[model samples]
Target: MAEQPETIKAFVKLGEFLGDYCQFAKGNLEFNEDQIKWLHKLDDLVARAASHNGWFTQGNILYAFEQWSTALKTDNLKKWLDQYDIQNSNPMTVAIIMAGNIPLVGFHDFLSVLVTGNKALVKLSSNDKILLPFFTEYLTTLEPLLLGYIKFSDEILTDYDAVIATGSNNTARYFEYYFGKKPNIIRKNRNSVAIIHGDETPETLSLLGEDIFRYYGLGCRSVSKIMVPRGYDFDNFYKAVYSFKDIIDENKYANNYDYNKAVYLMSEFKFLDNGFLLLKEDAGYASPIASLFYQYYDSKEYLDETLKRDADKIQCIVSSRPRRDHIAFGDSQKPALWDYADGVDTVEFLLKISNNN
Candidate 1:
């Protein structure tokens, strides 16, 4: 395994480069000659990534880069690593089957594998093939030792000591069947929900719009449902989210909104529409894009009980209330480095696999 400090230093360098590039791209800072050349090249690459996948809009890809730029800071990496004994693990190749729900959605798993000194055999999602490989190649330029540690394969995955797979519920069953005998973390479909109060101001609800509209509500942590007090008036909710009305301007988002709305109208189902988004009264947690599923809750206790019962199907709860389990409004997408998906400790799993090997 490469020395731990060297790995951390390389990651921090990548983070700094990302941060600087972001500032330069936004015209907030001037880059040096070499940086200017490379950044202009990066601008072209970002456009190529957007072209490769319509969902990977330039803005969303940059947002993902900016988020990870902050997450990979030296202090943040140190703090997260301090939580476990992440050293001296016998190197093992980890096979990672990633989902392409959002930009860099599979990156945390990639980071977990490499930071723990484990080689990664990653099968990049077809929709997200461009960015991760670009960055990994960049990482090798900074730290040559990482060259052999990272492998992206479009063919069959083989010679892996452990597995980490993420996909929809049906694919999860297949993953379990094939990888169950090995040390693994197989993540299934999960959705996030928001618990809101009737008395809350529209200004507050507007912030919740970020949770629903960001990434077109495609991520597992995106709020797919909202539970409000019984008979809660939605007038303010509608007005608050009117600020995000421009989302309809995007071709893909508008197509979904138009199609889903047509289906609801043809089926004669009752729903609230505010020109851009749909609010349907439903019991399900996973709502279609451009729509939010909502339910009426009579009491806090009932909400708590229902949430507890549906824990496995939920990734995070969005609430303004003070609860350790709850993420603040608009903050679900900004998960910390330690916020492992499915509540499974990736680092610990890797350590165990290493020890067993």
Candidate 2:
């Protein structure tokens, strides 16, 4: 088994490498000769990645790298690992079935498996094929002991003791039926929402635009719905998010906007439009791309009860008031190493797998 501390060291180095690579992608590299050549290859890799998935714009992919670079810092990695007793004398191979909605979406599971001294048998999503491979190259090169510990396969997954599968609610039924015999963590579709107390400054609402438009609203962490005070006006909100009007310029997003808008119009659904985004009074959590669903609330008590009742469907609650599991505006996508998806701790699950073996 790879030593846990050594694995952490390798990831710290990887974080630094990613930081430098982000700078290179931003065209700020002066010259490192051999390293520059490697970065050029990565630049091409980013281009190919974008080609594979139109939603993966350069800015979004680079933002993913930047977030991972920050999360994998020496102190951050150490702090996250400190929470787990990761001395696995027997390391189990964990099968990770990932989703490709965003760049490197399956990485936390991959990282959890390896960081806990377990082998990772990964099944990459077709939409996000190249980004993780680049990280695999970096990590294995940094630590040769990890060479066999990490594996990626597109074929049928086999030879794994446990499973961690992420997919839509419909696909989750298939995963449970197939992988139910093994120790598993299965996740389904969940969306985030925001609460507007009608006290936010324009600057704060501007930051909320990042939560809405970043990644073109494809990530589960993206805010798709918001709860506002009854009779609340949205003039300030629209003005604040005007900075993100460029999002409609993306062809895929624009298509979604046009198609969904046409359907709403044909159906005679009352929705507010601002040329780039649609604000609809919807009680539903999931909203179509280029649209935001909102509901009116009368009291804070009702809001708390509603959120608690629908905890299973909510990923993150973007609010200014600090509370348990609530994320601030613009910060939902930038999760820490410990912030497990679906609120299930992946490290703890993998550690138990090692212990059981």
> What's the lDDT for residue 86 in model 1?
73
Q: Write the per-residue lDDT of candidate 2 for residues 100-171, one digit (tens) a residue.
A: 999999988988888888899999898999988888888888899999899889898888999999999999
Which candidate achieves the best TM-score against the true structure? 2
In model 1, the clashing pairs are none
Against the unseen true structure, what C-alpha lDDT does each candidate score? Answer: 0.89, 0.89
lDDT of 1 by residue, 1-357 (tens): 223577788888888888887887788647688778767777788888889888888777878888999999988898888878776447999999999989999999999999999999999998888778878877898899999899999998889999999999999999999999988899999999999987667777788999998888999999999999988888878988899999999999999999999999999989999999999999899999999999999988999899999999999999877488898888989999999898998998998778778
Q: After superposition, how far is residue 319 of candidate 1 from its true place, in Å?
A: 0.8
RMSD in order of candidates:
1.7, 1.6
- The segments of candidate 2 whose C-alpha lies over 4 angstroms from its true place after superposition are 1-4
